[model samples]
Target: MRIAFPSTEKLGLDSPVYAHFGSAPYFVIVDADGGDVETVENKDLHHLHGNCQPLRALGGISVDAVVVGGIGRGALTKLNQEGIVAYRAVEGSVSENLALIKNDGLPRFNIDQTCQGHGRNGECIH
Candidate 1:
């Protein structure tokens, strides 16, 4: 499966996962089956409040799922509509998050769990 992780930098697997998907600087796409990884800059990083377009940020790159520390309700809904699942990220690097995913330790992101305009610390409020 192709998984995308919102990142603060382009450090490949070791990239630190950004707290909020919409404002993240980059995305690290990882191929779970082949262990390949690539980074893409987030095109819609500067979107206005509540105007995050998750797909646009991906720049048309197809990914099976996205792992993020937090995401807004609109972005989560958009991702669901596009058939891409979102998972709540664990506190770790892209590589560590990948490991958690492989072990089924990460929770699937749901609309009810969307962020409530929290700051960078990623404290999502229901």
Candidate 2:
């Protein structure tokens, strides 16, 4: 399965996961079966609060799922419509999250769980 993780830097699997999907600058795409990895820049990083475009941020590369610290309802809906599941990421690097995915440890983000606002430290205030 191909999994995408939103990251703040281009550290590959060691990259720290960004707090918000739409605002992340890079993405670490991991191929679980083949053990291949790819990093891509977010094409659509700047937008209004409710206008995040998941496909555009991913550079149109198809993936089975996305791992993020937070995501808005609109972006989550868009990803779901494209058959991509969004999982709530733990507070760690992409490598940690990848391991969690293998064990089905991450929780799928329901619409209500989506980010409604940002916290004082920039975490999801949902």
Candidate 3:
């Protein structure tokens, strides 16, 4: 499966996962089966709070799923509608998360679990 991870840097699989998907500066996309990787700039990086255009931010890249530490209800809804599943990210780099993915360790974010906003520490406030 191909998974897109919101990253704070453009360090390929070694990039640390960003706290919020829409606010991430880069997206490191990895092809799980083949190990192909691509990093793209998040086009909508500066979007207003609660108004994340994920598709635009991802530069319209096609992928099976997205892994993020936090995401808003609207963004999650949009991704679900597009047949893209959003998995909650663990505290680690993209490479670490990939290993967990092999064992289905990450959890999916439901609407109620979505962030209403971000805290000062960049953590999602649900």
Best by TM-score: 3
Off by over 4 Å in 1: 120-126
Error of 3 at 109 (Å): 1.2
Compared with the true structure, all predictions reach lDDT values of 0.91, 0.92, 0.91
Clashing residue pairs in all predictions, respectively, total 0, 0, 0
Highest lDDT against the true fold, candidate:
2
Write down the TM-score for model 3.
Answer: 0.96
RMSD of 1: 1.6
Give per-residue CA lDDT, model 3, range 1-126, as digits (tens). Answer: 889999989899999988889888999999999999999999999999888998999898988899999999989999999999999989899999999987999998888888898899777887
**Alpha-carbon RMSD, each predicted model:** 1.6, 1.1, 0.9
Give the Å error, residue 77, model 3: 0.3
Q: Write the per-residue lDDT of candidate 1 for residues 1-126, one digit (tens) a residue.
A: 999999989999999887788989899999999998999999998899789999899999999999999999999999999999999998889999999999999999988888888645645555
Query: How would you encode candidate 2's per-residue C-alpha lDDT over 1-126 as one tens digit per residue?
Result: 999999989999999988899889899999988999999999898877788888998988999999999999999999999999999999999999999989999999999899998778767778
